[model samples]
Target: MSSTLQLVGMGVLAIIALWVLLQLVGIVFSIVSTIVSFLVSLLLLAIIAVLVYFAFTALT
Candidate 1:
């Protein structure tokens, strides 16, 4: 009966460890996604600025 109890405790510990690891990985991915989104927005703004500059020069 004591050996069975030991096995149950070990199983619970292993499950907790896996859960913590998955949570850490999720956090890292979220941060990377945010950075990529910001970079994309910056690129779009740069393109729009270039187009506007050319249009203004043509009108003059």
Candidate 2:
């Protein structure tokens, strides 16, 4: 009975550890995704601004 109880306790602890690790990894990935998205948007806006400026210059 003691051996069985110890096995069960170890299993529970392992599951909890895995859950915490996955949560941390998910959070890190989410932060990286947000940063990458912001950078991409900023780059696109800069490109569009340059195009508009040149277009207006041509018309003038």
Candidate 3:
């Protein structure tokens, strides 16, 4: 009976560990996605600025 209890305890521990690892992985992915989105936004803004600059130059 004691051995059975030990096995159950180990299984529970393993599950908890896996859950924590998955949470960490999720957080890492989210952070990476955020950085990528921010970079894309910057690129878009730069493109807009360039277009506006060219337009003003042409007008002048």
The TM-score of predicted model 1 comes to 0.80
Clash count, candidate 2: 0
Compared with the true structure, what per-residue lDDT tens digits does model 3 show for residues 13-41? 99999999999999999999999999999
**For candidate 2, what is the TM-score?**
0.84
| TM-score winner, 1 or 3 | 3
lDDT of 1 at 39: 100
Give the clashing pairs for model 2. Answer: none
Estimated TM-score for each candidate: 0.80, 0.84, 0.84
The digit string of per-residue lDDT tens for model 2 on 1-60 reads 999999999999999999999999999999999999999999999999999999999999
The pairs that clash in candidate 3 are none
Model 2 ranges with Cα > 4 A deviation: none
Question: Against the true structure, candidate 1 has what lDDT?
Answer: 0.99
Give the whole-model CA lDDT for all candidates, comma-separated.
Answer: 0.99, 1.00, 1.00
Name the candidate, 1 or 2, with the larger TM-score value: 2
Question: Which stretches of candidate 1 lie above 4 Å from their native place?
Answer: none
Tell me the tens digit of each residue's lDDT in model 1 across 1-60: 999999999999999999999999999999999999999999999999999999999999
Candidate 3 ranges with C-alpha deviation above 4 Å: none
How many Å off is the CA of 47 in candidate 1? 1.0
